[model samples]
Target chain A: MSTPVQAPEAGQATAPRRLGRGTLRFLLPPKVIAGFAVVGPMEGKGPMAGYMDTTLEDTYYGERCWERTESKMLKEAVQQAIARAGLSEQDVDVALTTDLLNQCVGSSFAMRSVQVPHVGIFCACAGFASGLALAASLVDGGFARAAVVGASSHHDAAERQYRFPTELGIQRPPTAQWTVTGAGAVVVTGGDAAGPMQITHATLGQVRDMGLKDPYDMGSAMVPAAAETLVRHLQETGRRVEDYDWVLTGDLGRVGSRILIDWLKERHGIDIDGRHSDCGAMMYDASEQDVHAGGSGLGASACVVSGYLFKAMGRGLVNRVLLIGTGSLHSPTTHFQGESIPVVAHAVCLERPGTR
Target chain B: MSTPVQAPEAGQATAPRRLGRGTLRFLLPPKVIAGFAVVGPMEGKGPMAGYMDTTLEDTYYGERCWERTESKMLKEAVQQAIARAGLSEQDVDVALTTDLLNQCVGSSFAMRSVQVPHVGIFCACAGFASGLALAASLVDGGFARAAVVGASSHHDAAERQYRFPTELGIQRPPTAQWTVTGAGAVVVTGGDAAGPMQITHATLGQVRDMGLKDPYDMGSAMVPAAAETLVRHLQETGRRVEDYDWVLTGDLGRVGSRILIDWLKERHGIDIDGRHSDCGAMMYDASEQDVHAGGSGLGASACVVSGYLFKAMGRGLVNRVLLIGTGSLHSPTTHFQGESIPVVAHAVCLERPGTR
Candidate 1:
């Protein structure tokens, strides 16, 4: 059953003053009550298939269009997350969600059925972290008792908008990554009721342009952003690479993840080789799947972090974790105009109570 | 000049835990230090032209591409705003900005030049208030000392993506609202450094659909959302319609504002006649500009509020104000699919010092 949330007393305020300049030190961190993932057939068949709550036998998901299917998946994810938390839509105070579609169509349309307060945000692939951060802020600031954060990305829909249509079946580049087809949803509340899934701190990142115009090589373009956020988060929070049980990136793919590792070591002397892993690389079996670099999309990081990691943490297998969400901000028009790509990353500290 | 920000002591913690359910009570409401607006020649010739800091001789703004021009205007608006605040980009903790372009290209790219932390949000025409609301939260929650909110829209760019190309010169319907060509920027900071421009409360809105499918007639589609938020805000804040010196709505255009006013009186027994005005209606003279119903876009509301209203508050010409930002949550594809348009409205309560 759902219950009202209250802020922790002054004496219970455990966090240090807001870290650095752009970090939120949640004195009473919000809890992740439940999470759910819905993936397409290909993604369901991948290495991370077991983590998903539902996987469509076909990409259409019985919808007429791929965009419609995306909306369905997002709505289902929200419903499943609420059901898992034993709460109904009526109990939710608000929903913070977004996707890659123009005007955030997927989030707005999908969430319309719920009828709760909502705000469709846009942070590109970093949407998952952005939604989570805002949801946590809403809960921590006592604006909502329960805030739902959701996002989705469909291969069919994304391909035509960002690249070529699926009907073309154009030859793919080795550097290009597959857009994961799925949706992820999480229910965030104020307190430690959801024990192993507490959100303690957040570091919002700035935009970084790297002069890479090729959309296919987005992985390469997103490296600086991931590294920048990681360094700032570590420095501001007084945290070391080893402090986290796992440091996960949104969708850096194989190439970008390696670049991040190398850059961190060279620039900050911070080596996270053993402790760091990327959602993109973890989404599929790189060699077996045709996805050249790895899997990437808003869904990749969201599904992995919420579906896979939440269960892992619940089993006491993993404890403290840092999720660094990376997004390459660009439009087809901007790219066509020969402009550089702008990227960003936001990091959130999640942990089990025992680990803290 | 630029100083590191610190959280205030206990006595200075003047706000409640948070405002009403849907509102964020900024214990330490962030102050609007400065704002700037830049517009195209068409908008410069309108009624609100004097509110703009600069009016371009042409929509091209000396850029090769019209979209590039939009980016330039946004960048200049931000730079002017920061300078007016007596600071530079380095002094900014973060920038929360967005625009009408796909993937928020304009804001992200223009903001990359600033090199501060950036969060590209997308809420359609609600972007200005969305940006300001989030910026205020970042400051109030101790995440940033100085935050910048920016947004832009170019008529040529919006026409091409949302409708036919500018070259097409298609005849628009009477209900169609013209997208404004301009950008607006506001600098926000924690504490009350800018005494006359404090943001006190915010009410995030929910998605509302009235089964309207025409994209061109967005004003009619957005009326329900505007009314919903206005009523909720008034109910929660326990304020009468006359409490505010002004109640401004973002780009509902001529037709939508009339519908909103009628609905308010009929549904809530609230008559906001003389105290209220729509940014869309004020941006242009419907009879003279041939903008159909009126003006629409993030730039419309953003410019009026940040540029004109900020100055008014500073000079004691206005005291209490409520800005309700409305957004249409639909895309071209959604319309093609015959889906009903979804709309949203967010309200931010702003005031001059000594009113609290």
Candidate 2:
């Protein structure tokens, strides 16, 4: 405790929790006490089906629009999280969330009825990790006692916005990623560990672009950005690949995850083979599900981390874990306008307190 | 100082800075050292054109795409801000930014090469104030030594993404506000006041929906949310209209600002008539410029406050100020699907630190 994670400067008493270039050491780590996931029919039938708190047979979820439906999915997940934690909506101090929709209306509309003070964030697919990192920071900084973080994406909605309308039944390439239809929410509280996992540190990523302009090749675009954050996190924390039992990415999907692993080995000489997994790749059986590349979206990582990873920790299947939420920042309009894709990835270390 | 703004409940020495039901009181206010604004061709001809840091004769700003132009506009603004603050990029510990584009590509891509650790936020037009509030909080919480907050909007890009392609020359309603093509950036730091103004307090608004679903009528949608935060800030801080020299709304425009004033008077019995003005209304001559409702977008408020008001304060022409940033939350898809528009507003108190 005396030495602390960050060393004090010549004039400072408590060192600013700056880890390396972009990583942050949360001296006061926040506990992840509760989480919930809701998925659409397609996602409900995926590999992580058993992990979902609820699966909808109706994609609309009784809403007229896919955007509103996505909002409902997020709202229900957060509400379920608070209820599962044995608290009322009033007890959650803040809500950090965003969706795939423009202006993040899904989150704002959801929060309208939920009524918690909101901090809206947008990071494409990386929203889950981004939101969690911010909420944890707020909690550690004593800004909030309890923070509810949520993210969501609906396939039909994303398809229309990013590409052609679903009614067109547009042919997709093998490199295309199917946006997952679902929502995930997690409750983070600043206090003694009251749950199976706690967020100990976070590395905020830099926007990275390697001239990958093809919107269909997003996995390739995000892979290096993911590597950047992971490497920065390990170097900053002075940890190795062996430090974490599992190194999970929100949604690097199948092709990207493999490329990322090989790239990490070649570039940084860090080989994370058996320990690595991607929420995108693990969420679905690509061939069986007809999801060409793999799953990808804000909901993909949110569902995997909040539902699968949290439950796994609770069940003692996994203890120490590193969750890297990756996002590919591009739009069809921008793509048409000849812009290269920019990607970002955020990494947070999670652990079962006693095990760590 | 002993009798802190937030009265402790029972067993606390310093209150946690929670005021009334929703507002936050900063025990250590953060200083606003420098701010810069860059605007496009149309905006360069506006009323406050003389106040901008940089203005472009070409709306494209030499970029092939509007999104990239907007990003460049934001980058230049931040660079100008750091220069004006007598600091370098290395002095900025963190960058907070957002834009109207999907995934906030304008900001993410702009930040890709800026090399600053980033926090990507999305609250539509309210991004300037929202980003600054969070940056101030990070500085006050010791997460950042100095934080740079940036936001931007491009008229052509927004039109295509939100409605139609600019080539279509879409017919517009009188209620529709023109999207100001511009960017703004502010440098916030902890420690002594670097200039005339400091952020003293902030009230994060809850999402409010009044069932108005038209995308063009954003100003009307956001008016109530703006009023709510203003009233809450006043009641929580136990301050009256006389407490601040001016209370400004981000981009409520003409119609919305008038509605807000009347609503505050009728609903809360608080009349702030002569002392109030909106950045939207002040940005352009509505009738003469053919900007029907008035100027709007992330650039509207950002350009007015950071470029115009910040300079005014430094010149000792103004003292106390309250900036209420308003955002309308709705998508064209959601609107067509019959969902109501949701809105949010954030209020931050600014003042001359020593005088206060």
Candidate 3:
């Protein structure tokens, strides 16, 4: 593959951290010092039960509204992450966060108490990975010493805002994935910090839309973006599928996950059969949880990586992991307006230090 | 004031770029190579008419829906800015954009055609400042050689989403500000690039809430945040108000602007009388436009800076400018839920290189 190059502007030097067009190879890898996840009662009953830091008895999580519940979960996750890292609120530099709610109020309200400088980012479900990549870059570049990156989604909040209200008892199609009622936060510190996981590389995705207007089947609409970013990351970094111990994708459920495998093989001749697994698919037991396809939302991948994967890494169960967070960028208004869903995916590589 | 310092991690050197808790002192300042603005007919008829790159005869701008119009305007702004920079789409590294829309669809849709890696940020109207700071840091840190940062807002679109439908034509209170139908894009390159304006410093703001719940009186809700960021920025950078030729704020309109001036003088003992101006207040003539307070939106400060302010700078009318983009972070849902408004403001310092 040819290297993506631009005409050098003025005194520009080849940045040591930038590997390709959109891929960043950090010279001083940022360490993920701590991770925390909070989920609802339903998610606590799922396969990811033991990995979660806190599980609420209900979706409301003691709050009056689902939105406030989301904000609380996000706040708890971030506070827990910082605490687990042996740092206080004043020790962190910034909080980069986002959620599925309108205007991303979940993050804004949550950060009101976290009290650090807040940078609200939006990539739909892919927000966690986007935040992670940006936070890692900031730490590696010395713009921040430590950053708390998080994302959250409440099932009831997503249902009412993006689809039918929970009280309406609307029937979702088989292709529809359940929005995970959870929040996850990761504390990323600079290279000097010792941690189990290090962020070594990142690849930002481009917006990809193929005119798919079926909002119920977000999986189908998002496959192209997921495959695009995954392929680009591998190609740009000159790495093969086998190089990674786990190729983890965000909330691309059953259909999207299968399609991604086929698309990557057909389009780029990449084989990722055993190494690839999806956070959405892993979130719930197909038969027991009534979630049709699986779990989805900004919180799905976030919870999986921050809760399950990081814990696994600490136990030496995994070393090299590539997390690709996928998002379908569509709102109810856009769907009503007959606009197709635009999708994006961002990839971040996490490795145990000295794994190579 | 005590210097903001954290316990340095293992093998960590004191980063030369961090000035205070949230302020960044860019070692190699990013240059603003080009800027482009597109405004609706009403805005074109206002005082900023001559500086705008494009003016639409109607709000639709030839599009069928208001949302599409916003997306179109954002796309045009980014394209025009890139063109003005004498670069192709391939020359730019990424597009950092956001708008006052549900899930930030305005930016996602616009970037679908821009074909660059997209980073969507949300801080309500303060998004332009957030994007600029992130883009500047990315460029200065060598992760990106050049980046395009932009923000957009449409009057009807924002009105319908955030408040009463425009078709209802509900009477707005005197404290309400007009949402500007406009979009602006700025091209920022690495320090090696030669340009008229240079971004030397940035301060990311924390979420500030004074328990103000009035959706109509957003100016009042946001004043605390504006004051907080401005004070923090000045204190962190060790610069006085007089150091800047102009201290420009985003969308604080008439009432909030007055509150800010009085509040700063009373609380912080800093006088910014003659050097201060609000983008929203400057956009329209008080007598002719009939906008009760003034303009307010993500596009308000964006259009003013990319259109009028940059042009003024190029012509040597101003040398040092401090841009504080402000946002009231409460959504219609949050307002409906009886939650108080959370506000944020990010400040960016721009100056002519030789003058500094």
Instruction: Tell me, by DockQ, which candidate is best.
Output: 3
Q: Can you tell me which runs of candidate 2 are displaced by over 4 Å?
A: A1-15, B1-15, B20-22, B165-171
lDDT (tens digit, per residue) of candidate 1 on B157-273: 999999999898899999999898989998999766755588877888888898999898999999898888888888877778787877899988888888888889998899888
Better of 1 and 3 by lDDT: 3
Ranking of candidates on DockQ, top first: 3, 1, 2
Model 3, B1-356: lDDT tens per residue?
A: 11112222232233477777668877778899999999999999899999999999999988999999999999999999999999998888878999999999999999999878888999999999989899988888778878999999999999999888899989999999999999999999988788878898899999999998988888888888888998999898888887888889898899998998999899999887887899988888899998899999988888998898888878877888889999988889988878899999999998776554
Question: Which lDDT tens digits does candidate 1 get at residues A249-274?
Answer: 98889888888889989988999898
Candidate scoring better on DockQ of 1 and 3: 3
Q: Which residue segments of model 3 deviate by more than 4 Å?
A: A1-15, B1-15
Question: Judged by lDDT against the true structure, how good is candidate 3?
Answer: 0.88
Each prediction's number of clashing residue pairs: 2, 0, 0
CA lDDT of every candidate:
0.84, 0.82, 0.88
Candidate number achieving the greatest TM-score relative to the actual structure: 3
Over all chains combined, what TM-score does candidate 2 have? 0.93
| Model 2 lDDT at residue A93 | 74
User: All models, DockQ values?
Assistant: 0.57, 0.56, 0.71
